[model samples]
Target: MQCLYFDQDVTSGTLTIDDPELAGENLFDVSSQRKRYIRNHKYGMVYQNPVKGLRMDFSSISNIAEKQIAAGGRHVGNMQSAGERLLDVVSIPLFRMKEEPRNFSGGMQQRVQIAKALSNDPPILFLDEVTTGLDLSVQAAVIDLIKQIQRDLGISMIVVSHDLAVIRMLADRTLVMLNGRVIESGLTDQILEDPNHAYTQQLVYSLL
Candidate 1:
């Protein structure tokens, strides 16, 4: 569902990248190669499971640096420095740079994945169930980190989660999906407080 908005192979509906280089180009109509390029150069995605988004066996530095390399980075020193800085920003100690994410705690692994996603400085980010399965404190800390990064970088973020608390913290707008369809859409506060659809109302009430 998140992929539909970002030019993944959806069955129908028009999608377009708003960047100057790809101005008004219909994403669904574009060639697959072009779509791949757009995804590689314009967006970042963090999956719910770190394994899906990160190389578990690679050192954290290597995982983060790989994104830069894929985006055309050539200088090893520059890439290494950038990776270390991002890891520091994500609250992972620089001493852990040589360690693989497989050895880190769940929260730490998620942080490494986040660092890797941001390695290319993409304008848009997609997060799918990022806080699921984390301890409450760890989840809160990671959410705060994400919020800070969004504010500092001013990057566009689309977060997908069933957790209302997570949505309330990170989202300005909300789309309440029932099954595969969006049954309600509005500002996050409004959707939570004054839902228009029955499904949305029930969902919100359960949370309360």
Candidate 2:
């Protein structure tokens, strides 16, 4: 993250991933600002690579609780109890709440991400190929979890993926993008069963 003055001048930069920032208030300030933005938006990105994306050092519960804190909700101040509750909500045992994310299995880490996203209590959740790395059983569980969350919170979703099966399962509405343009879009079942565009038809057929 880069810190800039209100006048658009670069004030400082913090690269937490890089070895260059051994000790710096600049990065903390910038990351804080980013966290604030994420909290306000109530949207999250569940990246495809768990190893590369999630904070390996932060306990899964802490990661979720931090977002809740940034969102100005009733979560940050009571982390000890709230964090455990969140892990439970995501189906993680209370024992795992204190463990670092690297200790979790792939599916578990993804659940951690979901729990974290919901911590902010956002009205929408955008999942990018959420089930790509999971086994079939885990994929179904994850999909069911998303549906249940939507029902419970009345949240909307925009699931970005190239997999037709995944889109069919998750999206009420479907959109087909090609070279930056939306080639087809509508009710998911409609797009799947009776596509209007040739590209969409091709896509559906290929899925068969």
Candidate 3:
């Protein structure tokens, strides 16, 4: 994911760049600088914004292959080959292989985000508000794509969405958090039909 921090603080808050736990640890502490901690930390905290989390300079294809290149997937003279292979995997348009990401539409851009996340071959994918601004049709497409990616990749998907429709469609299990605590947790259908916690009830009712 591409994360841009204009006047943003990436530490010590809900961002959880350091720990998978999503809370605790002082940002001022110098120990947070280690690459090992950064790389291996939460695989399920999608940045609050999609555009903030990506590299705008690269094409969708380039972005997808970036992880492989970082891990030395590119041999002496096969960089293009590696890229083309990844493009096929991520479903990027081969015709626009060299276009910058700013040129794509919102849905296309989101697909690039997915491609970039999958590039590292992460076992768990975090999708934070992935469909916030899209219309229903586009939202459905993106949600379906995520499910397809998860199934084909065999990875756990943590989709953080305030939209119940998205949750009901994409989530296998659901967790309801209010005031920063988990108030309810169970299968999506169960939670939708019968929420035990008041916060969950409010949240479910709000969907109506």
TM-score of every prediction relative to native: 0.95, 0.76, 0.75
Q: Write the per-residue lDDT of candidate 1 for residues 26-54, one digit (tens) a residue.
A: 87788777766776778888889999889
Q: Per-residue alpha-carbon lDDT of model 3 for 168-200, expressed as tens digits?
A: 988989988887567889999999999998878
Q: Which ranges in model 3 have alpha carbons more than 4 Å from their true place?
A: 1-48, 76-79
Q: Residue 180: error of model 3 in Å?
A: 1.4
How many residue pairs clash in all the candidates, one count each? 0, 0, 7
- Native-to-model Cα distance after best TM-score fit, residue 30 in candidate 3, in Å: 12
Q: Is candidate 1 or 2 superior in TM-score? A: 1
Against the unseen true structure, what C-alpha lDDT does each candidate score?
0.88, 0.70, 0.67
**Which has the higher lDDT value, candidate number 1 or candidate number 2?**
1
RMSD each, Å: 1.5, 9.5, 5.1
Candidate 2: tens digits of C-alpha lDDT, residues 100-148? 9898887888888877776666655667678897899998888888887
Overall local distance difference test of candidate 2: 0.70
Report lDDT (Cα) of residue 125, candidate 2.
Answer: 67
Best by lDDT: 1
